[model samples]
Target: MAKNLLPMDALIAGYLHEAVQDAGITYRKLAAVTGMSINRIGIILRQESPPATLGEIGMIGSAVGLTASELVERAENVARTRQDYDLVANDSINEFPEGNDADYDHA
Candidate 1:
């Protein structure tokens, strides 16, 4: 399996994407206004390589007429929702591996 990464990042990205959708605006418009790129938008949406930076989020908030605090709060709420989803999806999840540390070098 691939290494596990925190799911909150993806949740935050999804929140931003949903906001754009709610505004009936395309990422291109946001891209032009915020000097962001469509390709990067996908990354932001997926919380992949192009995950949102604080500056990026601020720029997007400005374009969407959201206060900085409001935007951040929304992002946080979305992340929580995503966490809930992840918990449901991985009901039998383990947060860390179990093993005898002496067996091998651990990073």
Candidate 2:
């Protein structure tokens, strides 16, 4: 259930860490504020495990001065950036043959 929030782990961890820092809070403070276990917060911030539940994300975000939606968007942006790099690196953009475009009529 929590895993459904996002597919990527590292990006979300990065966002969490950055937000915590931006909010000028330590992991211990964040855990205290969010009512989450300090070890859980540490693990996620360290990229050992991602925060899976929306509830978890919301608590973390509230402590770090962001919203669950904002964090999700940040994670999505990171995923999109990674995808773009993967496509470019693999040359998938050129996978379609050069002559293929001519086979389809332009409206």
Candidate 3:
């Protein structure tokens, strides 16, 4: 079986789509409920454009009966789990070469 990997943004978008459907809220109605413009709500529903701020996320989560913290944690979890091997190479490491501190200093 081929490995299937999805981006965090796509995962979050899918989650929002499911949450809205489960809550029985249409996108237009959600716009009214959240006091965000239809265009903005469309962007959110599309999931291509994530909520710009924590406040925006709070509004969405509240409408879907989710806590803001819960939504944030879910997004973080998706991001954490979706990393590829390439990301491992970029992770921070503590190893440093030993050298004279005075020689490295330039002023």
Clashes of each: 0, 1, 0
Q: Mark the regions of model 3 whose C-alpha exceeds 4 Å error after superposition.
A: 1-10, 85-107
TM-score of each: 0.58, 0.64, 0.60
Question: Scored by Cα lDDT, where does model 3 land?
Answer: 0.65
- Candidate 1 lDDT at 4 equals 37
TM-score of 2: 0.64
Candidate with the greatest TM-score versus the true structure: 2
For candidate 1, what is the TM-score?
A: 0.58
Ranking by TM-score: 2, 3, 1
What is the full ranking by lDDT, best candidate first?
Answer: 2, 1, 3
Query: 1 or 2: which has the higher TM-score?
Result: 2
Q: What is the C-alpha lDDT of each candidate?
A: 0.66, 0.71, 0.65
lDDT of 1: 0.66
Model 2 Cα displacement at 73 (Å)? 0.8
* lDDT of each residue in 20-103, candidate 3, tens digit only: 889899878888889988887667667654433557667877889986677657877766776552322233423334665576
Which residue pairs does candidate 1 place in steric collision? none
lDDT value for candidate 2?
0.71
lDDT of 1 by residue, 28-95 (tens): 89889889888877677666754477787677767777655676676567656664455233644543
